[model samples]
Target: MVQADACDGDADRMTIREAIREGLREEMQRDEYVMLYGQDERDGESFEVTAGLHDEFGDRRVRNTPISEAAQVGAAVGAAATGLRPVVELSFSDFIGVCFDQIMNQVGKTRYMFGGESEVPLVLRATEGGTLGAAAQHSGTVHTLVSHLPGIKVVAPATPAASKGLIKESVRSDDPVMFFENKAIYGERGEVRTGDRTVPLGEASVERAGDDVTVVATQRLFGEAMAVADDLAGTAELEVIDPRSLYPLDAETILDSVAKTGRLVVADESPMSYGFHAEVMARVIEDGFFSLDAPPQRVGVADTPVPFAPDLEAEVLPSAPDVERAVHRVL
Candidate 1:
């Protein structure tokens, strides 16, 4: 007779944001060189993610910087080059513009420019999208912009488990990683594995396996696609894939999945123009052209600024219904 494996879990479920914080805390504890800093409003408060980190890690490790995005990012780059793994938060992804010069011109290009002599091992963490109605100024998904640039890795984790794993990996990586987290999904709960679980960069995770159609989604859109997939299961067996890390996309997995399903639909929270969805769709056509049954479909935010109004904003963004409709269209 064999004893069944029984596992002890966290007494209370934690949100995706909480899981990320836990990963950060664990990593910081393991690595003395790891530190965190960010421009958070409400007196060093952003989205409650860093609420207690400063207290636990002390002022030196969790120092709150000025409003200068470029300067702050530049400092992180310098710090990383000198051996510090600084995790800098931009507060909102939309504000990345302020630090775009440093991000694109300095940190991202350092490793390549220096011939790998210097490594900018930094993590830029931000809460993106408009679920809380922060308006156009605050809510935007600029991962596509950063992903297009070389030397930088972009990742958007859709679940608590992935969030924890991806955050830990990003903090430990030698490359500069742009970690985008949705503000809306911060409080969303899911199970996260503990004790050295690592999700590698540029890998896609199959959220739901199927054979009729393939739905590639990221972030919140992934959850929507899953729901839509469940609803469409009786009619069309739907296979849902979430490219957890966007920059170094797992094209093999996506291509293989599309080959099996013969159809592809990308659900993204970002705009359609030059977004990750566009990139994935283009890749599918280039490599999986013969495998595709029809043209690839994308369900995403319209190529326009997010509206201030709640209804209009909702209408512009992708949803479960939109995914379901796209699936039907592809089928």
Candidate 2:
């Protein structure tokens, strides 16, 4: 059930991190069964979003676990299957490696394996993507890897409003969800409702509507796409789409947009090969081939691991210029 409440409309002015904190706080308060726990360094992890949560929610509701990702996630799965909504905070998306067995073989496969006998209502929150000099070990956009797993949902929200709504929805979902939050978007602000206003699963929002090309993007790349759209407004018409949720993707919405524009471009910060951008392009080509006027285009990071150098990193990742060029080329 949606909370059906609204915020001051000032939430749009806050950062993504702030929005996440508010969402968690509100949800935990709204649902007595909701529990929060995860790995934290020194305290509530590197971002400090949950710094004081434990103090308010108490140890029973807000817990700080050991550095074992597998154990923590497994415990979350167990808790959820037993009738609690667990929010597992993964310190970083890369650390999911330590818990792959639990996530892929266990949490992701539980419901189906049990013949729908149980539902794992859990959200794995992690800081993902390149920025803030997090280096190779810490910086990674591994959503595609997780999105490939069955029985789990993957979502990336780039703005405050989306961050809040998406998290609320994920918490309420019966399926396990991997919620990727960009470290760079932590401080970005947007409007958010005070109560449960979910953005729903598998739906894409058209951030900017146009007729030339539909630039499907999400996360930080969504921002870049919008900027690129504005930059190229005088030259060509552009539509910016944010597929807020990756798994359970709303292919029809995207296809409808592309069908209207007769052109397509997918932009994502994840590496190009077999990544989110490529996946979206594949979807368009497979399901909406007749709607395209030109070949679908993609703008994303190179297929190599992220490097530490800022300049080299910029070259590897997608940018506004890159998205602009891809959209124009498709047009």
Candidate 3:
């Protein structure tokens, strides 16, 4: 289920940040080759995603880097190319722009460029989405751009369990996985598997099973979809799906759901113009056209820069009302 836990951050519930920390600790313990680096990751990032990791792994593995996104990412690429598996956190998803060349030209093309000679078993962790008032420069749902590029795998988990499972998978992946954590929904918590729970990189989880409409969302929007579905349960039985992995998207699962419901509404936190929402809509139209009863609806961020104010941020970002409207349109 998308809202797997009854409520977020319960007594036993683990926050997404805590789940991620557990994933890192377990991965680091299982494989000494797995090391973590990035700005303030050891001491704790601004989001506290890596807090206390330094003490557990020490300065050797959880080293800090300079404020050079390009240099640090490039160094990680080089390190992974050799033998070690390094995970680099970009801190903010917006910073990926600074290391675009290193990621796209080098990290994405390394194995293919070498004719399948070597693998880039590295993971890039970054905070995504707005609602933190981080301003336009710091906040964004930029995983859409990274997923468009080939060779790099992408995973965006919504709940604590989903985050924990996918993160462990990303750390052990054979290819470079872009793990986008939604900054807006980091504090929410849910049940996490006790040990060795690894969600495969390219799998989609069905949050709710309904026959009326299919609502596919990622990250923060995924939670919105699930909540909206439960609220609208009296009218439309919504089948909400979470595309945990964006690059190697679980297209078959999504297509099958659309076929069953005969209606699809894609929710993407990114802007709508040529955004990731369009990509999922395209897949349904191309692969499940015959099954669709009505034109698909898309819920996405407005085609404008994210506003820094809380009110404006809510206006620009996808919300429960948007998902409900899309579901209504399809119905």
lDDT of each: 0.86, 0.83, 0.88
On lDDT, the stronger of 2 and 3 is: 3
Model 3 clashing residue pairs (backbone): 2-207
Report the C-alpha lDDT of model 2 over 1-331, residue by residue, as the tens digit.
Answer: 1212355553346778888888888888999889888876226677987777787888888888887999999999999999999998897888999999999999899999999999999999988888667778787889999999989999998778888888888999999999999887787766675555778877777777788898888788888888888888878888888888889887888888888999998888888888887788788889899998999888888878888888877777777888878876876
In model 3, which runs have C-alpha deviations exceeding 4 angstroms?
1-12
Which candidate has the highest lDDT of all? Answer: 3
lDDT of 3 at 307: 90
Candidate 3, residues 1-331, lDDT tens digits: the string is 2333343333346999899998898999999999998988878877888889899889999989999999888999989999999999898898999999998999899999999898999999999888878899888889889998989999888888888889999989889999999988888877776867788888888878899999999888888998998899878899889888888988888899988999999998888888878889898888889999999998988888789998998788878998999888888
Superior candidate under TM-score, 1 versus 3: 3
Q: Is candidate 1 or candidate 3 better by lDDT?
A: 3
Candidate 2: pairs in clash: 7-194, 11-190, 12-190, 12-191, 14-189, 15-188
Candidate 1 lDDT, 64-84, residue by residue in tens: 789988888999999999999
Better of 2 and 3 by TM-score: 3
